[model samples]
Target: MEPFKVHILGCGSAVPTNHHRPSSQVVEVRGKFFMVDCGEGTQLNLRNCRVSFSKLQAVFISHMHGDHCFGLLGMISTFGLTGRTTPLHVYAPADYATLFERQMDYFCKRRDFEVVFHPVDTTRHMVIFEDRSLRVESIPLEHRLPCCGYLFREQPSLPHIRRDMIDFYHIPICYINNIKNGAGWETPEGEKVPHERLVTPAAPPRSYAYCSDTRYIPTLHELLKDVSTLYHESTYTSHEADKAALYYHSTGEQAAQVAKAANVGKLLLGHYSARYHEENQLLKEAKSIFPNVYLTDEGMVFDV
Candidate 1:
């Protein structure tokens, strides 16, 4: 099925630790790449993971927190230094545009390419972007500051070519392309070849949801329903649920509850608090609620 994939570049929270970096992730779908957040050292993480920045079509910032966006200025400057002329689209809260522009001015380096910003509504849920093969939606979340989660859903592709029927009918290469594109073909002799007879349905489209730096919010369940993969912040243990609420972060068990409630196929828990010397406890606690829970570390890639 060639399922789309997501890579966790960095997965720490406000404070970086020797074991974890700040928030950064890359979601690749339909042969394109979209980066979520750009915490400190994100570019290094990308290079370490062997993901080329040239492939990134967009960046979605969940919020303006330092852990979520401190690396953005550096990435933008690096892009300019590399002579990147390709326009970069960034979806973020309205205040981020001003913040970035101010930082750029302070650096005195004008970008070589256009930087378009799409301001997302942190209080409402909506499908904010769509291309031929995918749709990106913004799901509001509860955080200390305004934030919005991102949901990526790939659109179903055209049916696959039926090799047996194509061989049997001696279909021309041009006609085969048409069949794979969901179009029926008619021979010069006026004989119609139905697409169903020449092709099989493509694999079901998959979805990946990203929720970062947010407190446990049950309203998000419906928005993330049935997602193939979910990446949620687990900033602390269940024992620290009080601290999680006080700090507007999530405990491992709370993240698991969201995944179970949403019926997400798999869960990748990241954004760990620096206090944790080991992550095994977080995984154990989350897995108790959602069996498919996986602890995400820097450079971990998963097929969605």
Candidate 2:
């Protein structure tokens, strides 16, 4: 399976550090891109990662926090400067729509392309966007302000062709596609060749969930049952549990607990505080609970 690819642009918390910028990432699948969180310096990172703005179909903001969406206006202006004619969709909480439009009026006076805003409720778990191959859903979160994450799910592929079965039945080449689509073929003798004998079942559908800037919610795993990969914010370590709760953030351990509860294939940790020069302690703590966990850094790409 060609899984969804996530390119990490920035992973730092509210405060940017020498090693990290802010919270931002680009998700790609089947050559199409979707951005999650447009923090400061996201455009530069996009260029640095070789992910062209033309491939981005939409942007989903987790919240109105500066670290999460400060780069939206700047990116929009840059898109205009680069002569983008395709309409760009931006999804965020309903309250942020007015402020976003106001900012666009002041900063982006005239642009050829349309910048469409889609207001998300930030309180419901429902499908917000979908295409023939993929769908994105909202995951409500607990934060100081209204926020929601996104789940990208790929559609199941067609069954694989079986050369041996085709040869045995003397099937015509024109009928291969139909067989893969779960159709039954009749031989010259009028014997039925079932799809089960003509093709193998397809791989299970894959999914990736992006959750950041929220406190630990034990019930969140229920919404993430079939997700194979989870990019969760580990803003602090267990030692800073008090601070994490005060700021409505989760410790590394809490993130891992959520992953374990969901039974996900892998857990990706990011969104670190500025104070932590290294996240070794955070990685180790999460590993104690969920073994298949890794840290995501700027410019790194993960497929799941």
Candidate 3:
């Protein structure tokens, strides 16, 4: 079966440090790829991660900040240079449409592919994109400007077949699929087997939420319930929460508080400030509140 994965290409604040790049990530559902927050040099980061540009179905921008959207033109131009024909969809704030389109038209007018812009209202908490197996929703967040997070929810999967039950009942191969699809089996003597008995229940669906640059919003816990994994910006330590608030960012302790309140399975902290020599302080602060939290790194792949 295809796997769901999140590839972290960049995880730094506005200033790109030697240890980390700007905010960028590639989320892979099954085999389809979606880029989130394409900051400066995102195209190079994509190459560094060995992510094929051809597989990217769309790009999702969290806000209009330079650190969140500067690399979009280069990524689109590279797609054109590679001779791609399929349309590339970009979901971002409505105000970014005019400038983004103009830049693309000037730099990539000769390309064969089409760049489709989907304007997103940063204040809404509605589904922005959906396919057969996945749905992406915008998360309302508190920020200096219009900014929002994203939630990736996977659809429920089919239950597994019970081979032992089928063998015990002497069910033929033809009826095995029916059992998996919630159908019961009957022997030649007309003895019936219940659908619930033939197969175990499927696992619950998994969800992942990405919170970019934002201050702590107390009401976010209600919206983030049932999320399996949460990636929130932890731009400062607990002591500098005052500074974090002033800059519209979150401290490591604040991120952990959100994770604990939301009851998520795991929390991944990213978007660290360059002031910290290492992530030990950040990780310690978050782990003190939420034990299941982990610090994100460049080129890291997380399974959801």
Candidate 4:
């Protein structure tokens, strides 16, 4: 429960507008930050939002699109200049490995920290990253280029220890961890104290899904089933359905359908086209289909 949240850095499409930037967001799970899509000015956004640069563990790029990854080199260079020593992990399509290496060699020479690249398939659903408290999985998406989304799932925490039981039984502090791990305690009088009596069940884990720059792909529903919150691209309104299909992008209506199919707790609409001065039309269209849709704006934060 330690801030399972998303901070929207940018939410515009390919073209940058005075109002919105490209695609970028920071997902914080249990106090650790994972950046998704480092669009232009993402580092500046991070600084403006007061996110600690040293706490950013990794960056996940949805595709090779400039709108999604153009800021990566700049961010890396900035990190180098700031004298960061921790290794920075970047996950992107396998095809970007060569390009990334070339850019790093030319711009990031003799850096203090290492840039670790993790090549993603972009065509399969797999657990790409895991820690003690959370896991990140790649969710294949339909796009003009090879692209994928990311699913962040929080690992279930240990059950709450029963203070009354511990106090009554005089259980040693050292044995608390064992009890939390489902071990029963044996009393000195040869009595068995079951773990069930020492701890309560843990709360269910929560999950968030980020589906950016993808068309309406039905297959994605299965991967996103029952997610706590979903951030899906809504680059156009229902009126531009034809254009959306032609460009392999999603309309607001399509994004809502995906959220409805997946039965998510809430749907966040983002990646808006610059053409619209206001997102009311897109929000209206999506809400007509799925009532729980929310619009994304720069600097907006959502707790999941």
Candidate 5:
């Protein structure tokens, strides 16, 4: 089966203006919701986009920047108000634990659900979360403070058993697991049942890379190589490249370079600086280098 979808809720950067909010996205995989960055007004964006907060299982923060995490406390508080019982897991940088806990202390309302914090390793790339369907890894990026990006790799499914073969050969249900695991079965007569005859290879897995706020760091090439989709923060245009460098942010062209170098199948650029009224120039700049580059609009859902 194909993995779940990813939705871009709010894609503006800090300096939020009337037109844009901040950074926030919803990545749904295998029927679970994983939120990334909860800037101010994120919950509203989620509501407008018709996403259910109750289904959200995890939130991944890229850094301590308010634009990336300011709405977390509010969201959790609302969850408390709604009497949520399911535990919410938060994966973020180490600093976020202190900040989030302090905010929760201000509320002081005993949460009906548990909130577990899993800090991402900012010093190096690390696999912070994994399961049968997907794995999430953190890639440290060049920022004024400790910041990181995320890579979501979908795991290939187990080989599916050929039901027809089972019925034809009168195969026992006891050996189904072995066939799914690609192990040949042995009958009581010591006859070998080849795995290939019982099962078929699974579909290839899809992958997406989310490069949070960062400067034009070339090493990201290796970290994001050949992903199905890449979402990079293009906070500035080429004219503002100097300013982006000073602020440890990336320009549209630079974002495209990373995507091109990484050989990604598609590039979705967002996190635009509030300075620009329109992002036509930014999109044009990125498209020059990467043909598959696209400007991410709020509420746009990218089905991976």
Candidate 6:
């Protein structure tokens, strides 16, 4: 199994505090890195985590909020200064295209690479990016601004070859890939060998979902159904449920409810409001609803 992990870079909410930074995280799938919501101090946090800056494949911005995208310009500038030649793709709302272009033109004039912008429709749930190992889709979220969550799903690999079967059938190395792909083989005497005898079933595919700055929208359960891990914003406790609803944010209890409804394997609660000097209350609230919930902290890594 290739490395599949989520690194919590910064888990604070809009207001920065001495104890916490703003929203940021890195999702690593099969050695490829994808940044989600690059808030202020994200680059520094990335360095703190020892993630190679050059390995970042793409950046996904949930919305145009400053807390979610303020670090983007600085990161881009730094990448240029570091002599990065690989083009970086940024996915965000279409409204940000003009602003991003202007900022890049003025601040990153001597760049060695191109910054490609992909407009995302926050209202729709659709596949926005795909690679050999995984695909990322946009999950429509209800928030004060135009925002959408991200669902990262790993692609199923070919089945593992059975060494004993290979030796028993005297299968040629050239036919291993075909056998892994479910093709059978025939011996010199025309003895048919079924694919099931040559290879074992592939491991089940895994998926992770990142939902932030959103209200308690029930539709989310459907979007995140059976996800291996779910990172959802828990900006407040149930005591402030009314306030959370007013601000289009979810409380810790609500986050746990969603996780339970979706049947996710694990729930990671983040985007904490600065008011909670300690996260114990939030964790307790969430745990009361879903025992598998975990409070996301900076520098914490979760394998999915």
Which stretches of candidate 1 lie above 4 Å from their native place? 169-173, 181-194
List pairs with backbone clashes in candidate 3: none
User: What's each prediction's clash count?
Assistant: 0, 0, 0, 0, 0, 0
Please list all clashing residue pairs in model 1, or write none if there are none. none
TM-scores of the models, in the given order? 0.92, 0.97, 0.94, 0.97, 0.93, 0.98
Q: Which stretches of candidate 6 lie over 4 Å from their true place?
A: none
Pairs with steric clashes in candidate 5: none
User: For model 2, how does the per-residue alpha-carbon lDDT over 5-68 read when each residue is reduced to its tens digit?
Assistant: 9999999999878999889999887778999999998899999999887778899999999999
Please, what are the lDDT tens digits per residue for candidate 3 over residues 1-304? 4578899999998887789989999998978899999999999989989989888999999998888898988888888888789989999988888998788878888988878899999989999999988999999888888899999998787788777887899888987787777899777889888998888888788889999989988788888996999999999998899999998999989999999999999999999998987989999989999999988888899988
lDDT of 5 at 176: 83
Candidate 5, residues 1-304, lDDT tens digits: the string is 7556789988899887888888999998888778988999798898887878789989999988889988988889888888789999999888767866776778735888988889777877988999987899998898887899888888888988889988877878887887798787666688888889888888778888888899999788998888889999999999989999999999999999998999999999999998899999999999999988888888899977
Candidate closer to the true structure by lDDT (higher is better), 3 or 6: 6
**lDDT score, candidate 6:** 0.93
Q: What ordering of candidates by TM-score runs from best to worst? A: 6, 4, 2, 3, 5, 1
Candidate number that wins on lDDT, 1 or 3? 3
Model 5: residues with Cα > 4 Å off, grouped in runs: 185-193
Model 2 backbone overlap count: 0
> Which 10-residue window in model 1 sums to the lowest lDDT?
100-109
Candidate 3: lDDT of 110? 91
Name the regions of candidate 2 deviating beyond 4 angstroms.
Answer: none
